[model samples]
Target: MAKVHAEAQKEQILNAAARLFIEKGFGGASMQEIAEALGMTRTAVYYYFKNKDEILTALVEEVTLRARRLSSRATSEANTDPKEWLRTLVHQHTMLILSHHNEFRVVDRTEQQLPERAYRANEEAKRAVLSNFTAAIEAGVKVGVFRVVDAKVTAFTMIGMCSWPAFWYKPDGPKSAEEIADTIAELAVQSVIRPARRQLKSAGDVSEALALLREDLDHLSLMIEKQPKSG
Candidate 1:
């Protein structure tokens, strides 16, 4: 369809702009340069985006929107399973960074240069992602699955870990994005998971537990018998 084709063209422009923004700082990159990069005329770029600021804002919004949507979907799908929720969130986040490293890096590097609207949208998206992560961690802690820790702090830490890949990930690296994501996801899950301890077996465990209960009851009875009688 024509609409689909137009949307795809818009995405190409955004991708070209992201690369230019990374190579040249947001303030350094110009509309002409972005147009040239895409092999289009300056007027063509302008038709899609009025100015460099508009392009930058579009880039920021696209990346943030992607992350926010991923977080929402992961949270909803794993609503009943906090451990799975956290794992899914971390994995998806990691993949997002690696798959779109240029866009991620551009936004990360141009925070101060972001337009007012873009900045607000970025901050709101961040808060939404953090809220999902914190809530999931809190849920796990409540159910005694995750260790006791500051859920907000843990969420922030994991987010930082995932975001760092945007700076250093290489497409030709030994590990693919999915492999790296899997490793990090597992690490995040294990970090909060409750430590394992020896479990009581069905036979001896039940007998030992009952014996301890009986001892406590007998001690309570003795203490009550020793109490002075009321008139």
Candidate 2:
């Protein structure tokens, strides 16, 4: 497992660099500081990453690669149903941000400092992700599954909403990442789903009524599960 060990060590270096980049801007953080953070010599750090720029590039590449994979998986899972597709996208995106908040924050804070290659790759990945959201919203509108709204605007808003948690999510918080993801997914779906579709009492047919009731129950169950218990 030499390769596995090597990969793990590389990840350790990336993680340390991300933390330093978040605390100090990319320019402010140096290779020596990163090495010190990881209890490694400057030479050891160079073995993994040639320099601070290379480390930042690695971090950006890792984040973009994961985003691309996430979009592919979400699209494959709900190709036909725009509502399901959007929900899946939101959940996955939120989970990704929560899991890699430091990396995400560093990238955001140092956008101008990113290497040309890394910046280009990141923008491409972001455009693809946005396309997924926009296409899903448009499909939902076409099928009358969602209300009439600007798909691009909604996509941008939802994306911003999902990314906001990266600034404040806490690993030791009361809610787990999965729980927060579910909550955000539900909110995103609700925002686009037609008003009649959301209200159980207003459902026009028995099947529609049942579906709405089920969704409501699922959301209610999640809320109850998240409640703080009395001593």
Give the per-residue lDDT of model 1 (tens digit) for 67-152.
Answer: 99899888877867688899999999999888888988888788788899899999899999999889899998887778889999
Candidate 1 local lDDT, residue 30: 88
The whole-model C-alpha lDDT of candidate 1 against the native structure comes to 0.86
Q: 112, model 2: CA deviation in Å?
A: 1.4
Q: Write the per-residue lDDT of candidate 2 for residues 120-191, one digit (tens) a residue.
A: 988888898888888889988888889889999999999987888988999999999999999999999999
* N/CA/C clash count, model 1: 0
Stretches off by above 4 angstroms in model 1 are 196-231
Candidate 1, residue 210: how far the Cα is off, in Å:
19
lDDT of each: 0.86, 0.86
